[model samples]
Every structure is written in structure tokens, then in C-alpha cells.
Target: MGEIMGNFRRAINNTSLSRFRFYFQAASFLLLIYGGYLALNLGDQLPTFACIFSEPRGGSCYLFGLQHQMTTPWTSYLSGRGIGLLVGFLTFIAFFIVFNKAWCGFACPLGTIQDWLTALRARFKIRYANYAEPTFQRLKKIKYILLALLILIPMAIGNSFFGLPKLNHDFGVPFCMICPGRTILPLFSGDFSQLALDLSSKSKMILTALGLMVTGIFLSGSFIKKRFFCLFCPMSAFHYIFANAALLRLSKDAGKCSRCGNCYRACDVGIRAIADDLQHKNIVKDDCMLCGKCVEMCPEEGCLQVKFLGLPIYQSTAEGFFKRMQGRNNAK
Candidate 1:
């Protein structure tokens, strides 16, 4: 078992093309587009598959129509329970535990869009500041606060402790409403207005505020960091909270590390894999999206791997653990 595991680790560290990762990512993007399309055109016809927030005021949609019920200002909103939300959330959790944010790396449409934008910026020789630097690292905490607000505000509104329902009425799934993925869905469907809701004068101010927030994300992506919106996303918050036990992870052979800083430089999240404690090397950070770029960029073979259920998968080598034992003996 140990021999097979070691060989498997070696293979992943050596290879560049990860088909499983790529396919899952492609599928995710396709699904988001399709779902958005349905939301825009077929929303009136299809039974709500899963809408966690509110009933489409316009039609008989059905997947998870509970969202419409929760939209009442006096009630706490629950938008993540609809069939689509359930499936998406479950799939995200399963992938997180199995691949440790691989969804963020490959499957997330939001991440994909951000990567595309980042690529464009890179083409122009522009790049954001590295998150590893002390000055920039503080920014990572912003997401946690955003996450807390998402949960707390809804609870408060539901409890009637505060008149937060007024806020909820203006913004449905306030956290998700501003999501870049949500924003992109409408654009992909050729109807940018689909994401917008009709509002009164008071609600219009709220819309303006939300619009500015989204605009800020776009501007930040263009001039600062790619996917700056991700820093404050509630979905990312949920992923970070639940992906702690992810099966596949970025492992390291610390002894072999030359500490050349290549992996850190290669990492989109700017995690210092080689320098961190071996126990901390699992790509387990809340910000880690598991894109496999670090694994692809590492120069030393057998130094990193995508561990599945704590076992190595995707790539493996013929040299078993016994070979390593023999090599050590011979060296001695």
C-alpha cells in the first residue's frame, strides 16, 4: 500500500495534464450557463428546479420554490435549498472533500471568468500584488467578515430583533445577488437585465449601491487583483468552512524542497507551500482554489501530489516505496 502510494505521488508531481480536473471544470461551466439560460428564458415554463430565495414573481418555476417564501421581509431568507442550489452545494462539498477546492480551481464558473480576465491582464503585463506579502495578506480576512454578515443579517431579520427585513426585501439573497457568477449568468444568456429586479424609489437606491459594489469588483479585477469579488463572497465563505476535510490535497516532500520559491510564485492564492510546515502543506487554506498550477509548476518529482481520500490519485510512478528504501540504503 505504501509503495503504491509513493509511486502515485511521484506521478502526479511529474505530470502536467490532469484530465479529471479539466473535465469537471468544463462541466461546471456548462451547467452554470445552462442554468442561467433556463432562468432567463424558460423560467416561466419550467417547474422551479431549485430556487432557494423566492418564487419568480413572474412565473410558475419549481425546482426549490422555498426561496420565494423566505423573501418576505419578516422571514429569514433561505436560498441555498432549492434543487439546483442543493445539487450545486452538495457537488461543491463533495468536490471540496475529494479534491480540496478543485471546484474553485477548475469547476467554478466565477473562477473561470476571473482566470480569463486575469489572463487578459497578464497579456498586457499587468498583475495584482501577491497575497503572501504581509501588507496584502491582511486583505484575506475581509472574506470571513463578509461571510459572518451573510449569516448574521439573515438570522437577525428572521428573529425580528431588528428590522433587517427591509434590507432583505430590496436585495434577494443579498450575498449571492452580487455574485460575479450570478452577474455573468445574465450576460451569457444575452440578457443582462435578467439579474435586475424592478424596484421602487427606495429599492432603487439599494440597487444603485449593489450596482456600485459589483462595479467595484470589475474595476478591481481590471486594475488590482483578478476576481477581487471572490475575496468577499459568501459562497467562498461556505466552501472554506466545509472544505476542511477535502480528500485530495497538495502534499509536499519537504526534504526535497530547494526553497526556490517557484511553487509560491506559481500559486494563485500565493500560499508558500515549500516554506510552510509539512502539516500545513495540504493546500487547505480557505483561499486555495486547487487549480493544480502549483502541482504542474513544481520542478522536483515526488515532491507534490493530489491525494484522494488520503491516497494518491491522478498520477503514479512505477518505483515503489521499497525502491526508495533501497535507494536510501545504497546511499548510506
Candidate 2:
């Protein structure tokens, strides 16, 4: 049994994790983005960007449902509507805790699109840019602010909190108003209608304008920088709140890590902590997508691992690293 297990581990480690990820992501992107055509409906409580605006989306993102539910009248809190909202939130949490933020790394259509742009840039021999550590520290806080606003704005629209007047209904789904997914994903289904600016109200006009601008930036920036939009994604902030109790986890063996900097280089979002932090056993940071790139890149045996309920599914190993390198060299 021990020898068989060892052979299985060697087989897995010898395979190209990057190639496996690319195919897995491609399959997931298809199911989420185009599965509705086949009558697939996962639910409305998914943690990732399965944009409802996309006509063929198999599932809907939780943030959109959360914003819609938040617009419920204040008096409904003691009623069945409140119970329904609670159920919805719990459902979202259930889906989220299973994979933590792997939804963002593995299933988000927007993230996949950004990665495709990065690939296109690489194909053209263009260099990708990284944010300076100081800039990254500052920018990472934006997601939380967006998450706060996403919750508060919708509640304000329904109830007069603290003598504040009810906001205009034109501000419906405020985050969705500016989310690039609303504009980008629909294009996959041959729908360019989201690009049309709403002239009906000042709030809507401004929101649509901002949405278009952000979409433009999302396309151009993602080409030059890896996972650009992920830095400011409110969903990422939401995921991190329940991350510690998640079933899937990224763990580091500080004793095994040599701080060789390879993991840092392979990271799509440029999480320096993965390479630098030495104290934390649970190394899943706020920006980490649990994409397993660090583990794939690490040269040390048992340095980094993807664990499910405390059992390691994959881990770094020297033999695996050399095998992967040899495969790449032979391909070249």
C-alpha cells in the first residue's frame, strides 16, 4: 500500500500542473459561461462571477442576489422575506466554504478572461507588469471598501437608516452597475446591449459610463498585468471573511520553505507573502486564489500544499520539480 501510494504521488507530481490548470479552467469556463443553453442551473448563490447578465450563465453570482435581497423593505426583517434572505446567505456560505476562494481562481469567467489576455500578451512577447509592494498594499484595501459599499448602498436604498433619505431606485444593484462582468460576459453570447448607456436617470447614466470605462480598463490592463481586476474584486473580500473555516486550504511548511522566490514569480496576483512569510502555517492570504501555482513552482519537497480537511492533496517535491523542468526542456 505504501509503495502504491508513493507511485501515485510521483505520477501526479510529474504531470504539468500548469497544463492541468489551463484545461480545468477552460472546462469550468465553458460550463459556467455557456451551460445555461443546456438548461443547467447551479443556483443563484454561487461565490464566483457567474454573471446573471450573461444570458447563458449556468449559475448566478451571490453578490447580485445579495444586493437584490438587501433592497427588501425594512419591515420584512421579521417576516418570511427575512428568513428567505438568511437561507440565501447560508447557501452562499455553504458553496463558498467548500473551496474558499478557488471559485475566483478556477471558476470566475472574468478571471479566466484576464488570464487569456495575459496569455495573448505572452504570445506576443510582451512583458507583464507588477505592482510595487507599497502600491499593492494600498490597492488591496479597495476590495473591502467596495464590499462595504455593496452592502450599505442597497440597504440604504430600501430603508431610511440614521435619517438618511432612501436612495433613488436608479442606483439598483450598484456594484453590478460598474462591474466589468456585466459588460464583458454578455458579449460572449452575442449581446452588446449592455454597452448602451442609460439616459433615463442621472444615477444610471453616470453608473453606465463608469461601467464602460472600467470594462475598457479591465481589458487593457489585464493584458499588461496579471489578474488586474482581482485586486479590487469585492467578492474576494467577501470570501476572505469565511476563509479560515474553509474545507480547502493552502498550507505552508515554514521549515521546508527555502524562500527561493520561485513561488513569488509564479503567482498570478503577486502575493509576496507566499514567499516571504515564515510564521504562518495557514498561508492563504486575502489575495490568494488557491490556484496552486506556488506549490507547482516550489523546488523544495513538502514545502507548500493544498489540503482538504487537513489531508494534503498536492505538495511540492524536488523530484516533481526536476521532472517538470525536464518536460519543459524536452518540449522546447
lDDT of each: 0.53, 0.91
lDDT of 1 at 165: 37
Candidate 1: C-alpha RMSD after superposition: 8.6
Q: How far in Å is the alpha carbon of 169 misplaced in model 2?
A: 0.9
Clashes of each: 19, 0
TM-score for each of the candidates = 0.68, 0.98
Model 2 Cα lDDT, one tens digit per residue, 87-153 = 9999999999999988888888899999899989998999999999999999999999999999889
Poorest 10 consecutive residues by lDDT, candidate 1: 44-53
Give candidate 1's total backbone clashes: 19
Error of 2 at 165 (Å): 1.5
> Which stretches of candidate 2 lie above 4 Å from their native place?
none
Index of the highest-TM-score prediction: 2
